[model samples]
Target: MPVHFSLDEYRTRVARTVKAMAAADLDGLLIFAPESQYWLCGYDTFGFAMFQCLVLSGDGDLHLLTRAPDLRQAQQTSTLSDAQIQIWRDLEGVRPADQLQDLLAELGLTGKRLGIETKTPGLTAYNGDMVRDALKTERLVEASDLIAGLRRVKSPAELDCIRRAAALSDDALDAALAATRAGVSEGDILADMQGAVFRGGGDYAGNEFIIGSGEAALLCRYQSGRRVLDPQDQLTLEWSGAWRRYHAAMMRTLVIGKANDIQRRMHDAAVEALEACEAAIKPGAPMGDVFDAHARVFDAHGLTHARLNACGYGMGIAYNPIWVEFPMFYEGNPMIMEPGNAFFLHMILMDSENGLAMCWGHSTILSPTGVERLSKHTLDLVEL
Candidate 1:
């Protein structure tokens, strides 16, 4: 099999997952999250946008139900035997969902307590309703976070992928800095960044590179508007570098010209917040402590109203819409920082009074000794 990790690694992951399954009282788990599948069984595929499910039983049994296009995909990239792979038929009477229910029945899992990832994109509303109605099982429970929590603690191999992606993130940022200038369109800069990402040996990011210039910089969402850069406006960029589906993110704001006093102050506070966050990333620190660090800086600067509620989140093994994993940095979150955990801590501050924004942050990995910054790029408020 062309699995990303060795078969031994895959077995280890399955063992850990089975332990979690036992703890949750899940006799069977119907995994719809693509990342969870890859982590558990090395089932790599972008085909999750369609329909597929990796069934993991507490007894260490594994099975996959997918369509024709992903049948070979699962065969080549996963460690499933031919007998364990079930191809769902989308026939008139036997829909794929019906086939899924049949497969569960064949395995005698229909009557057992089962866990499913209800929030993943791979689990659509139609398929969800279909599966529920087909099985008529009240034992189905929502268990998205159960596996996500396990995946948050990166393995050595996983960290290597993220480290490479982090280097690519620096390259993309450098390309963005090189391509950004007065009169250049945001789309043009974004295109340059994408090219840099691919040319630097990075895969497609989980989400579109968020870019905006002028007052639109306050909006962190991605848009296709062809807004041209101005001499005095600032450009905000929020993006990640993904390698083998693992991600490392960076957020920065670049001014096309000289920065004003308000802009500089905001930038300084954001930078301070980022540094404080890094210092607070040791093992045993609560996730909220990092956000507390971020809040301290903004509140001290009297910009509490201008700051975001969430500073950042874990980033690894993700797909479209976002690269963020669970255990985000927010107020009162008791999720503790542990070794092998990787997260991005961004300080996004928007000064509505001045119609300017200053976003500066980077991702880091918690080590046995201390926290290591994943991105090598300098965290400076660049004036292009």
Candidate 2:
């Protein structure tokens, strides 16, 4: 298997998961979140988009039920072998849940208290009902965020991946900035950025690369053909470096020409907010306190209405639709910060009145004493 971590790491993860399972009073854990399953045993595959499930019993059996395409996928990318896999045909009128029921029985999990992640894209409502109906169990607890909570804190091995991923993000940003000249289409600049990522041995980000130019800079997403850049245009880039599903997010803006007074003012405010946020993020600090720092800077500068409600969020193994993890940085979040926890802090100022977008931030990992910026990129606003 092309497992990313040592076998010992997987063993450690499973042991931790077992302890969590016990705390939740779960005899058998039915995991449909690919990240959770992969963390436990290096079982990687996009087959979670369809009907699939991994059964982890307290007795120490990791069983997977999946489609035919992932048969070899699990072998090459995951820890599961053929003996441990149960393939369910996708034939018409044949429910994959039937196969799941059979596997549950094989693992002696019939009617046992099963903890399942009910919120992942992997576990469809139809299939969830199928499994629930087939199991006839006494307790089926919703443990959607159970593994997510455990994974928020990174291990040393995971930190290494985040470090490399952060470097990859910086590389892409460097390339994109170098190519951002007057009269260039945003699409080409975006191509250069993503190309740098792949060439540097990084995987595609869990979400779309948020890049735009000029008026589109105020709008944070990619488009087919943004207006050509001019001498006084602005560009915004917000994307993550993905390595083995771990993400290190970074965001910044580039000005094609000399910035005006308001532009510089907005940029300064954003940078201040970012620094304040970094200072507040550390072990023992409340998660909401980080956002409070951000808000303080913006509110001080009279940009309260221009900022987002949230200043940051957790980042880890994520799939599309978004990359931000749960327990994000919003006002009043009571979750305490912990070491090894990775999160992104971006201060976005969409001053439509000024027709400018100045955003600045990066991903950081909390430490015992303070926070460490993952990327080497400077937080200063880029002026071309």
Number of residue pairs clashing in candidate 1, backbone atoms closer than 3 angstroms, sequence gap of 3 or more or interchain: 0
| Cα-based lDDT for every prediction | 0.87, 0.86
Q: What is the lDDT of residue 185 in candidate 2?
A: 83
- Writing each residue's lDDT as its tens digit, candidate 2 over 1-384 gives 479998888888888888888888888888998878878878777789888888889866789888999888888887777898889997878888877878888888787888889888888888888877877753788988888888988899998888888998999888888899898888788889899989989988888998878888897665666677998889988988888888899888889998888888999999889999999987887999999999999999999978999888997888765777887899999999999999989899898887889988899988787788988777676888
What are the RMSD figures for all models against the true structure? 1.5, 1.4
Question: Tens digits of per-residue lDDT for model 1 on 161-240?
Answer: 98988988888898999999999988888888888889887889888889988988997888877798987889999988
Clashing pairs in 1: none
Best by lDDT: 1
Residue 344's lDDT within candidate 2 is 89
Alpha-carbon deviation at 372 in model 2, angstroms? 0.8
Would you give me the overall lDDT of model 1?
A: 0.87
Candidate 2 error regions (>4 Å)? none
CA shift of 262, model 2, Å? 1.1
Error of 1 at 102 (Å): 1.4
